[model samples]
Target: MSIFVRLLEAIGIASASAPPIASRPAPVGPIMAYNALDLSDPGLLEMMRDGRIGVSGLSVNERQALRNSTFFRAMNLIAGSIGKLPIHLMRRNGKLTEKASEHPLFNVLHRKPNDYQTASRFKSYMQLAALLDGSAYALKIKSRGAVRQLIPLARRSVKPQLSDDFVLTFRYTRPNGTVVTLQADDVFHFSTPLSLDGLNGVSLLDVAADTLGLTIKAQQAAARLLTKGTMARGALQTEATLGEEAIAHLKQSLAEGYAGANAEHDWLILEEGLKANAFGYNAKDSQLIELMKREAEEVSRFTGAPRPLLMFDETSWGSGVRELGLFLVTYCLMDWFVIWEEAIWMWLLTPEEQKTFYAKFNEGALLRGSLKDQADFFKAALGPNGAWLEPNEVRESFDRNPIEGGEGLPRSGTTAAAIAQADKPDDKEGSENGA
Candidate 1:
């Protein structure tokens, strides 16, 4: 029995036969250590391969720290927005087929991807990790030569390899001290800013660390002030003489009484001619808010996320919101959509099937506007002078069932030329009356 069969059986899947092997003894070549660690940095790859490095800077830990931040949480809006979109499978003739979309492949992707996480969670994690780490992996689970389900692998545990024959394989470390190798055909490796050699992706954190780190520091400083009462450039002064121990006791007492949310508006009695004075402004100071806002704006610019989408600017109203939404869908979301769609198309469909089948993200669904706005847009689209879409076609977009006889092209209002032609007598009738 092979290790894969044992694994499947351990997962409660009854396996009757051994899995088929497609790999030709990985051609005795140099093993590549293409992990999440920035390969662009020399020696890091070697260190990771030799187990010399463990969670360095910009590690998965840093990614989590960013998630914990206020401004960093705003970045998640991009991934969350795009990840929930529906992926449709279509044929070469541009026909969407239920067979393809309802296939087990999509069922696993759209509903239950793994035993632990839903499709939404899997997609959200995959997209965020890919954005931060520049690469994400999904291990293909198969039984008896057929793919059963896709399991998302932790970005931290996967080190990929590109063999001389261009065969991609991954070395994944499990939580129970077991290691498994997966073929490229068995794994869905999604990446962004894919390198020219295609061996590894360039981490966005590596490129934008200075910016992200600054925001992180600001958050930490604010947390310290809020929780530990370390007010910026402020200190307590006393006129009465006191022993060193008493002074230390007073400071600790003040901190205990006036720290965190519990300290709001709480009065403190002082003795020995001690008076409280505040020098620095509170955290609500516009300057600090502006600084954080500026940093957030810069991060949004780098990520191509709309400022309005992140709630950075509240002044945008009505059409501004629509325009910003369009900008997000066009400039930011579409790029990621294309990346995911291409990856799915290439991997889910074989070479022969690729000629006829493809995948696409439903961009129209994301680009939809308000009810009134959509109605007006559809009216213009269905107008006879500029007729583009039929009434039924428009209704289908709103998920409303098409009406009978609604497929015909609409007619334009009466024109002066048409009225004149109607009033004129027929030439053949006039000639027959004369004869």
Candidate 2:
């Protein structure tokens, strides 16, 4: 009977048999029509203004926060680093493990998850959503009792519901006004580490909204200073008082003569005894730059990204860059990797399969050093003193095809003849008598 119920009914969510609002669980809260309804509707606008609808009341908008250069760079750096890495489905056989390439889900994870998106693009999109919106979701399209495709769902459009029986479901409102209720097993959900109730994750953006607001405000102030600040190249001053009409005319004349890129080098003509005074960079301007830098540092700290990776500092080509890369992997990416792996086990793999199968993000690419350093590492791995890595295994790391007889580990000071001679049993009497 209420406007909210009517709106829900109009969107094909509420029906005659639907339970009354008071009877529903309290913690589920009101179903927010986030961008699902016509926002231009006056009734909707009224509800939003009156706080009847739970539209995002973020102090800083998520999209606007991304517009900041430092925030964008930090997000891109973290998301891209996770995206570019290869995620594989691996099976453990005792102490040995190998890529489960033959599994149906393996291709979905490694190469293509769906028809429209590659693994990299899909992972990147999910990572961005998780970082920005606190959670990410994908509907698992299954075929023949196995997952076939993963369709991404908008974070805002999907509402999570948990019942008293500990069962979970998702009420997803699509763009076309259709509402679909999905089971917990049918959706792949990834949440941020900061979860209070253990069912939903807290948004990092929302948690750091005040800081992001300051960053956005600082950026806007800098823009205003550049466009309308008194630190311009020069300004006109007059000793004689002038009428409003005269002042308007002088302002128009100055703008027409020297406003844009075309008038940058044009000479200003002095009229009515007006004098021009040049301006230089002042302490205030320097302070603004420092303020922006400090805000960037704050954002970097929130994202757990190193300042160097965010382009705040200059890292040399070899070791400096390598160390930073390692730091990023250890501090920032490792947790994300574990999150994805555990989520995959929970949502993608079956109970029996989870015992032997697992997902892993191969971060070797990000942690790789220079060519020489890699060579030395591989050399040490394949060394004779208790060689743990096979020649073919090292080649596989380099993306080279395995060669014949490369599976076995090599030993130093050992040749085919030496091996054959060593294999032969020696007669002690023959050796001592020189027979």
Candidate 3:
């Protein structure tokens, strides 16, 4: 009785222990990472709209680099967002001007003329033109220094000694535990006009249909918003109601629960991380900037990458403007690997399309052709891990180039060029070997 019965029980136990051979799909364990954006997931594209996802911000340089790559369109979508500042302030105080675009104040900042500048500077000037449409910018705070009057309005500011050097700069940590050092002058580049195709991972139609049916819904809501006043254009309302709708669309797309926004949530987590490293929150000082600043020390480090000490001659808004968060957005969109991974609206492209994608993502071709020495400098900015710059070293290096505007030019065109040259070597060696 015992031996046969025991053997049968053992067999039963063994059968139970093994995985079910051909059963219906069973529930898996909890999801721990950014699987919402996973392409293999059945509803990935559809989920992109349903408030379960969002696109991340891409930088200016990276966006342009991947403009023609497979991910370019998706990146544009991820990066586009709406920021709601006290919108009333925009009406009563801010002017409707193309400050960054047509009237980019950076163009007013002169540099020692060179081939790169003569060519590249014009491109920046055009960028300002595209963004602003030529409107005078309001000077937020008048900086003064004896160097203020330098010709071409070089970065020399003529600030009275009385003005406190209050804007602080420091290094911070990101959610992924990466380091990003930020200077006080680093601009947040709020979700103003996120029209560039930086977010190519998900489709806009998919996002609109999902997140509150937001694209069309936002347009309808913004169109209906009673809130309106003097805008920068000297118009009688806040941004054209449609413009407000677009921004709202953008902001909601980035907030928690937006599909493809797993990266953004991670970034915010990084910002909060700053709280552990330094001064405690004053909670009492409720100023928005102060509130934001309370979070800033931490934010700076979380998005931290090494700032390169570029060889330009400006400081105020030059290399010091664009910080680490923005750069991540830029690089991710233009990154060769990421773009190549998502080829053609989920269809996967042929080999020829991959070639074109690689070419566009490789900005080195343009840089090397224009400036050899400058290409070398760009190579130096790249970190050992292929990052545009090291988390710690970036701050000081990019400071050297002439900072015109159009997402603010780097001081070192040479640095950018240097990286480009190394990325793609000359085929001259192959020719020599053949000979």
C-alpha RMSD of each candidate structure in angstroms: 12.3, 9.9, 31.3
lDDT of 1 by residue, 354-405 (tens): 7876676776766676777786677567654657766788788878998876
TM-score of each: 0.65, 0.73, 0.18
Residue-level lDDT for 269 in candidate 1: 81
After superposition, which runs of candidate 1 have C-alpha atoms over 4 Å from their true positions?
1-60, 67-71, 94-117, 142-148, 194-197, 223-291, 314-318, 408-435
Query: Where does model 3 exceed 4 Å of error?
Result: 1-287, 294-337, 345-360, 365-372, 375-435
lDDT of 2: 0.79
For each candidate in the order shown, give its overall lDDT on alpha carbons: 0.66, 0.79, 0.29
Candidate number of the best TM-score = 2
C-alpha RMSD of candidate 2: 9.9
Ranking by TM-score: 2, 1, 3
Error of 1 at 352 (Å): 1.1
Q: Write the per-residue lDDT of candidate 3 for residues 48-92, one digit (tens) a residue.
A: 332223232221222232332222323232222101000000011
Residue-pair clashes per candidate, as listed? 0, 0, 101
Better of 1 and 2 by lDDT: 2
Quote the positional error of residue 336 for candidate 1 in Å. 0.6
As a whole number from 0 to 100, the lDDT of residue 347 in candidate 2 is: 98
